[model samples]
Target: MATTNFDCIVVGSGNAGSCAALAAKDSGCSRVLILDKCPPDWVGGNGYFTAGAHRTVHGGLADLLPIVRNVSPGSDLASTIDMDPYTAEDFTGDIMRLGGGRSDPGLVKTLVENSRDAVQWLHDRVRTPFTFSFNRQAYLVDGRQKFWGGMVLSTDNGGKGVIDAHQKALNEAGVEIWFDTPAIEFILEEEAIVGVVARRDGQAVRLAAPAVVLASGGYESSREMRGKYLGPGWERAKVRGTPYNTGDGLALARSVGAKLTGDFAGCHSTCWDFDAAADTGDRLLSNQYTKSGYPLGLMVNSNGLRFVDEGEDFRNYTYAKFGREIMNQPGGCAWQVWDSKTTSWLRDEEYGDGVVRKVWANTLEELAETLAEDGLQDKAQFLDTIHTYNLAVDAFVQQHPTTKWDPAVKDDLSTHSLPLPKSNWALPITSPPFLAVKVTCGITFTFGGLAIDPDTAGVLSEETGKPITGLFCTGELVGGLFYGNYPGGSGLTAGAVFGIKAGREAAKLARRL
Candidate 1:
């Protein structure tokens, strides 16, 4: 029985919801409210569990120098950094190539063209502390910071900093955020959404708003939904983000006859720590549970055989889709093998001390014996795999004697004469103190949800294939942008881009009321 009327209401408190709320407030909505289903502890949604990497277009390092707060162009350290400019064509090619050309061309164009401007908005309006990702995206190759994979900028403290910056902006603009409120259904009048009915403080509350934006994330947290949509054995995959994104937005939109789109059977999954919590992501460790070092080494399943070409591309290009490969392997798990040569180069945040459970031995045979206790099936096979792989590397080096191993580029330091080839960064894992870590599939978000108008972010109707009058959507709830695979760091950018469109249109609708 409290005051429930609002000019506009945004659901979910994740990156997209926060952006929508801020944009709505800035677009002339006097009273904007954000409804979050989870408690205050889960404020930032999946953004809190992310590494805060934002991929965008730029004129190389010179274009990015004005936005980043970490390094100064006049400093000596800046002289050693090598960053290439990423054009709109480059961003679009990554998406279309990874998605197998199934991505909506209209949505892809909108996202690619506006990505840099959206990131700039975050830096200027939202006060996001952008910094060059020296620790994650760059490698200290030849004593110079060489950035690869066309991704350079990330938040200063990763996802925590991103959410903190959004929170600060929202608070400054007087946006009302109601936690522990789960939106149950849209209040439809003659098939047009006029408001939403949510559970607030253990009671059903109707919040009257002319425009309602559903940015409440995906159904990755729902094991039932995952099993139903993503096929069998998907329920066993570990969740890498919040547990509250359980298809509430999809269900609400479905009730209003909204069209569902995108790849229901696919999701953004990665090689996570084998010992990580299965139910939800750890707030403290966050994305540190990621095990992406396989590119610099080799991966063998429990059956003691390599399954994927670990160096098929840069980690950013392959990491999101490789988790499904692990799930298909024996026992739905695998172990990455590295020797003393490349173990020192692994990112300290993911493979560092106290971050993951590591198995080490002085010899490959000893490593196999130790890993056998931890689910490895065959010791002889593991050793044979290593021996054969090392021989292939030697053969490749013999053929190309001048080949230099460089992680910053596709140096073609690859292995030949193998059934499945390691295309690049293939070094012999024959050094002392061999290291291995267990890895499993950890899903970040689902790729299926409501279809929306690309220009206004308005949810489309299922029957007539038109925009639903007062309903808008953003974030993971807006489908058609992705299919089987996604480029790294583009998720956050897409959310911000659509969030701006949804907020401006929702604010216009609220004004009409």
Candidate 2:
């Protein structure tokens, strides 16, 4: 009913969309507009629930010191410790390795090469605060702090901080953001993108723009889409973010001949609290529902059988794929069992607020009985599995007497001769007071989305194998970067890199148009 005009239109107000709008404005676009389907209060999309962990390429803390503000005294401590530099080669190798060699080489190259610059842009240009990931990465080693895992930086206050900084940047840049406005379809003139038709205040509003960037997130919140793409039991999976991402971006782009790529059946899913709310995850305690320490202990299905090799890789590499494994388990649930030896090392979210479906007992048998009361049917099988696992751990420890355990690195401690052998961080469960936490699937975002040009982030046409003019996409809506699994913290970095690319390129193209 109403018509609005802008130089660039960005869909979604999450990290990518906000960054796209900012980049558009900064790149000489006079009028850049951002539209979010969610209301004002619930804007920012899925990034609002993230920890703001960014997987970036940097040459030690020196490359980061100038950009990161209000940072802890790390350079002084680094004299004794060696902070290894993560290079583009290392970043690309990790992505390809973690994604099972299925990742698009072009997208991987873009992500690795521009990751540090993207983060630096946020710090210098967007005014986003940065801090070291001391909690997840740093650990005392030989009286010095050692940081591993290739993920060393995060937003000052995690996702909330990133969103707030982006919002502030957008406001200062004079970019217009419209909440409760969902882009329903793209406007094309003879197959060239022009604008969008968005539903605003229950009315179809026409927003005319020469360039449009779609950054709305994936279909994680859509049960119907999940059931369709991710298979039958995925409908029961808990959404780990906003309820706004319901495959609309994917559906809209596909309607106009965009090529869908990546693993449609895969997503960045993880083990969340079984009883987590059906519609959304808690922003305050977002990661609490995420069971990431399964590698340090063990996970058993309802049938009391160990179904997966928990220590196959770091949590970052394997967590995304494990949720699907949990879904396939009996009853679509699993128990993350931990003994007192390793229980204390768990992060605050593991036992903090909103942990309701956990049970503690003085003995393994008692724990099994408690599990029985909570719907675990096979008590004997559970005890037997634990017994076999403990024996394996004891045998391994006896061979390697002086075990060096470090949570930051994959240790030499491993279990052999088990059906699902733990490849690292294996320890005996002899310590009393074992605990178990029930977990179900928490779907973050679907990996399947429209294919895009690697350099420009322009959506590609499947038929022509050419970039769609004036049409760009980023964030979870851009496919081929991730496959069956993803390295943790890479999602945000990719979003920022590609968002900036999409915005700058779209602005340049729009100016010409």
| CA lDDT of each prediction against the hidden true structure | 0.92, 0.86
lDDT of 1 by residue, 93-178 (tens): 99999999999998999999989999999999999999999887899988899999999989988999999999999999999999
> What does candidate 2 score on TM?
0.96
Task: Please identify model 1 stretches exceeding 4 Å from their true place.
Answer: 1-3
> Candidate 1: lDDT over CA atoms?
0.92
> Each model's TM-score?
0.99, 0.96
Question: Quick one: best lDDT, which candidate?
Answer: 1
